[model samples]
Target chain A: MTSPSVPAAPTLTPALGRKLHPWPVRIMHWTNAMAMIVLIGSGWGIYDDSVIFHFIYFPQWARIGSWAAESLLWHFAAMWVLAINGFVYLTYGVFTGRLRERMLPIRISDVIHTVQDTLRFKIAHEDLTVYNAVQKLLYIVVIFAGISQVITGIAVWKPIQFSGLAEVLGGFQGARLLHFLGMAVITGFLIVHVALSLLVPSTLWAMLAGGPRLKTPKLEAAE
Target chain B: MRSPNRPATPPDAAILDNHRAEIRMLERRGILRGTLSLGSLAMLTGCDISDDTSIGKALRAMSSFNDFVQAKIFDPNHLAPEYPASMVLKPPRFNAYYEIEKIRPIDGPNWTLAVSGLVNDKQAWTREKIATLPQREMIIRHICVEGWDYIGQWSGVPLRTFLEAVGADLNAKYVSFQTADDYPSSIDMATALHPQTLLATKYAGETLADPFGYPLRLRTSTKLGFKNPKWITAIEVSNTYMPGYWEKLGFNWQSGI
Candidate 1:
């Protein structure tokens, strides 16, 4: 791979893609991302609704404070949206076979070397096209994180029905702790995702426009 | 140029040659449409397999463990404070489940409690025998784990008197309560003899309903709603501790609401 990276005069040029993201994948992916953000924000609101947080309490509008019944309802509603959207997206990805293409990490040594080179800043920005191993791992972890939120959240919501579950996790209190921790992890990951998007402008377009663009020579070598 | 087996199926050779560039472009950029499709598909395999592989075992362990821990926490000798009727939460909420099926029989002088276990004496006490011994009354909140609270007045004979009657063995660490409903619960011997704990029959001036453990019930303010067992039938001092149904299932065995 380094042999090809010898700073050779341009031999390959990028061609614009006619097909970007498949419509379903694009829709579901973006929606899932948005839904998670809303859910996380609303979850924070609900958690703080009951407690008087540092120097501040939730405004009266934020909660009826009529024994927290309203906050509880909001939590349940947001949870349903996040769960349903995630389920549909996951199902479609499997049935349609798009998951295979997007999720499989680049197995070739060349891609690994390319990632190392990019990390070292040895490779020019042009040489980067394939997502590095780190990206693949983050994406996968987020998917599982969403799952954790749902499972732990259920353990909190209906400790009796899911009592058996509550028992294993050390009961309702334990489940609540896990649920809060899961949200925190997701929030941290989102911060990193946004930073990366800024680092590489193409990331935004790639998701929005469907296919990422490789500056010409890399595209040529790739072809 | 296709082989006979391929016979008219679009030849891989031709398609490969034609689409190789497009495929390369898609692959190189990682802008492929199927990223989530692949990830989600893999996750699908993980989804249906209920995560609680050892849920049953954990439940059992926890129930027993909770009882053991709660026993260790409170010295049954020191009782929870019983407040006057003024301290009761007004409009007491009826939460969880409360019911009564059997009442004290008319001319009811003979509700008896059996004490058996690692004790020197195994005996049964008639209601008349218990009432004659010692009586205590106080009001306290029944804090439900489900987040409801209610305070009710209770009057009952002390469990210590029963333990003293049976002469519980010094080594006995646990006390098990067998309710008339066939629902048996156990707590630490210390919890059993808690000062505020009682084998009580009267609730708010009337005999407890069968659902409320009619003849007698155990009440401890330190623990959550469920710890208070109703319908006292048999009290056994034991060497080992274990959890009841709810505790085994996943609730905090201590369950101090």
Candidate 2:
């Protein structure tokens, strides 16, 4: 077996998009999904313990780890998983050119058209291998949100050690606020992404089982 | 990330192996069996598939790893930022496990800092005696693990100076403090020797209030506010790991910022 990101002039062709969700991508995606769920739930628990906005509070059932201390454990542990998983995903994206080919060069006109199609209830799902403009935009924004969340999280976690990062990110309070906002953005993305996947169950299958295969296959080489 | 799978549709053998691998992992972890909706997906992912004592153990291990990381990254010379006098909060915000009305008042003049454990000089020093030591004042942020912080001026002898003066085993694993408030907290040797760690007797140029750490209190820049024990009674330098009040109740013992 070869590394998913490497250009192997061999099995599992990308032509029919059979290589859409390689094992690494699939594993990391699922792992990160679980990690994000844990992080978000436990983070909410921690926030509720000593709330930033006193009036706003997350319900207990939606939270992980019975209390704030336990929540912190879940949060920190999940944070490591997220960090490692994210780093791997990023490396894979860059090295394999998946990020450039699938998620870049987003044009305003394309975004507008995608929105128009969605509004008219004419959403297209003909090509499961490729991302729509809206999908690309959403993915890009959430990636930024994830990056910001991690940065602010570290700053809040150790303001004294990462003093400059804390200061730049707005100290203790500001870093927390940014982190909170990042969670909101990611949560929103999850709702949309999940709903879309469920709406077109084929996308879910694509992620789960590598979707469709070509009748006549060539050695998968091209990234 | 897992290695590339050869076929678009995995064969029955691969499927069976994946299931076997998942079960093996769960058995290896000794995790409590629960009806996990996505158990297969969560396998080998370093995530808790269900709520159980197993996750708790995993988290405790992570906390210990973090403690190691904290110590590894700690710099002896790096000082926590000092604030201006204007930034110092006069009559700083009060926080204790108990209520303000329940503050155990102490007679400041009669207070003696009893030193014990791994020290050449185990004599008790009175408030007057500590006052005579070289004083270093700093205005640093007092941060709470609860996510609030305050800049307050604390003036007292540096802990490094006091530890050396007392002929303490500077290499001791822990420096523990027992407060009159019945709160006990301890810090690592590295943090104890940090230039900003102070046996602060005064706040904002005046002696600490009775509700605060009157007579004497441990003020550390790098630790959580709870680590700063108030209304001190005794200091012990020990090689043993002595978990403090909150620490025993599940807070990280090395509660460094």
Candidate 3:
């Protein structure tokens, strides 16, 4: 909510828009993007190195580095970057009240309605600042999925010392399976996320350059 | 029942069937599948997955928790599943840091296993004397960290028998092993005393081939292949943790599957 004394869009212009993402958010966003790419690519190679399911195998092209050892190095290195960057982003979000404002206040009804709206193709691209119920749900899920990947990653990486964590995940073999499954979930989310971004090009613009270009509609006057 | 004219299933096929049944058993026990879904994970770990630092810390802490749980649940008496002799892989895969051709042959006649550290018997064990110890044979799959696995028949004195004969301090925390090839490794005492843990002398019913760590090797199904050190030269039991070659390079010390 904007204060009464301050203008709504400080840098709004006919051709451009105000900054929606702060510098920290933008920096962390790109860093996270890079980390995810490295993680998924290297993760595939690691998965192929080990046999989990008897019948299923990752395609060769999906694998990252040439060798298992090399892929593992990339996976570990990217993991650290992802973890630290995620930590900073989360800390900033919580302390700045951004997480609460954006992702919270979700209701079961909102989720159900959003799913129905999505299925019927009736959803509107109304407000860039305000996340739709479906967007909120997905963002939350993806965040959690990232965390799960890290946890399962550690369990598989160091099963002996982390035997308890691995055991909770089922065991060494089970942890490997869960790790692969987590990767699959994240990959699925990435696909849907990219498609949605393409559908809403303004959202992509906001992510890359802070905010979307548009005229303030009557919704702001109502607020 | 099969007709007399029908051919019997190949030995390797039987082994594969046994492996499949074992996997099914694990699945049934909730060890391989269906137990660690996202919902269950959320419940088991109280922190929300979106809470990065808390979840990371919690998961790291859980590693130790896992170690504790595994240590408690480990059954020293429980044996790794064994296969029939016909299932043994021909020319069991040679795996080592060095190439097979570069492996320096240990002179079998003069070779002796040195015993040291927290043991009453400090005398070296000659191959002949080691052979006289009560022997055991097992056909177990050697799972490698690199992911391939092979079933092989290993014949040796039970490590427990050797430890007891050496008057080892059974309460020691760790058992360190040093190989003639300069590769060092260790295992927890509980694992050292496991019935399946072997001071292997032979492979495929004959004396261990040079490439397979002739004279002696450590063999156990509980651990990954790297944990089973070959060309073993010395044994030391101590309270302090001594990391192995791969373990020093970030591999888990307790590499049990």
Candidate 4:
């Protein structure tokens, strides 16, 4: 009753799955996901509140909150999370060479081949450790899209304080347009991403658990 | 390419008209298809945007709900930050529904600001009378609903002073303004009483140019540029709600920064 005994370390077992995602990447991934959901929902609420596009009216049910003020509160609150998490993700990715290691060495021919392979329904399921050329390209595009959204968002939020930035984006109206387009593009990516995840359920499981559940060929061979 | 010598004929005109009709048909199909998707989504939510009246009502309800939330959080004592004089944009950009050239020149001498509604002193205020009131100046950013902003140096009598001088019922729910340019707008009593709310008579140390509101204009640092009605002609204090020019057109009524 006085002191609890420390348990001995268990015997090492052979590795099963490859480490597809590090802890930081997985944590930031989920945080970014939550932030994106709030941002998009509240953003739609704001759009309905002041509707820049007359032709397209997003359904009221899709709104994040009942009121514009409420939506704005949610939006700004989520914005801070997204910005900080994105900054950390980018910095870590760059410094640790993870970005270059996982997403780079992508060639034009590789992209062309990936597209052909995808269209032919012949995407190889063997390699979960590395992103396909198309996936890498999409990830790169999403990174730029996120950056653009943040810039345009700042321009719209504090036009007076960041007048130069707004001007660079072709003034406030231009920034608003760009911001909306970025959201649409991100939404498109999210749809495709979810669909792809459904196709390979392990990818989602790997992201959630931080490693693949099944042993890779290399790991099995090593054992 | 047609032969240079060939004369344009009725059959050719018929063919052209047929082509035009086909294009119109295609355009209509595209629009119909887009609306069909939207209508189906609306149906899923049990809110039909197909009917104009119901959609308008829904939008209005949402807007009013926003107004209530904004009013609940509004702080009368909170002041918008005053920018440095150096931040003031020279030749502040002209903004309005119409072009600058179309601005109707108001006769400054004949212009009398009529005050009405829940006020005890419903006197017609003249430019001379307004100029006599204690003046205040500040360089503040003018944020527009369209998303642009510009810092401007504005000098005028504090709106609170004008309201007190006129014996306005500070307890009233709202204060409305009618501009000479046919724009009608209102602010919440809390915002109206805010210290930064100004009955601006000068811009950039000079009398307001025609492009800007001339003679007299409401310049509040707390609200958007559209909320600051240019060439203000009348002021009314009321307990009831009144929508402004842009507010009537779906912009947020409580458009605080």
**DockQ of every candidate structure:** 0.02, 0.19, 0.05, 0.07
**Candidate 1, RMSD to the unseen true structure:** 18.4
Task: State the TM-score for model 1.
Answer: 0.43
DockQ ranking, best first: 2, 4, 3, 1
lDDT of 1 by residue, B70-89 (tens): 44544444434455777665
lDDT of each: 0.59, 0.82, 0.76, 0.77
Q: Give the TM-score of candidate 2.
A: 0.85
**TM, chain A, every candidate:** 0.69, 0.87, 0.84, 0.86
Cα displacement (angstroms), candidate 4, residue B241, comes to 1.8
Whole-model alpha-carbon lDDT for candidate 1: 0.59
Q: What is the C-alpha RMSD of each candidate to the true structure, in Å?
A: 18.4, 11.0, 19.9, 13.3
How many angstroms is residue B76 displaced in model 1 relative to the true structure, after the best TM-score fit? Answer: 5.7
Winner by lDDT: 2
By TM-score, rank the candidates, best first: 2, 4, 3, 1
What lDDT tens digits, residue by residue, belong to model 4 across residues B202-235?
8889999887889999998767788899999999
Candidate 3 chain B worst ten-residue window by lDDT: B40-49
Candidates 1 and 2 compared by DockQ, better number: 2
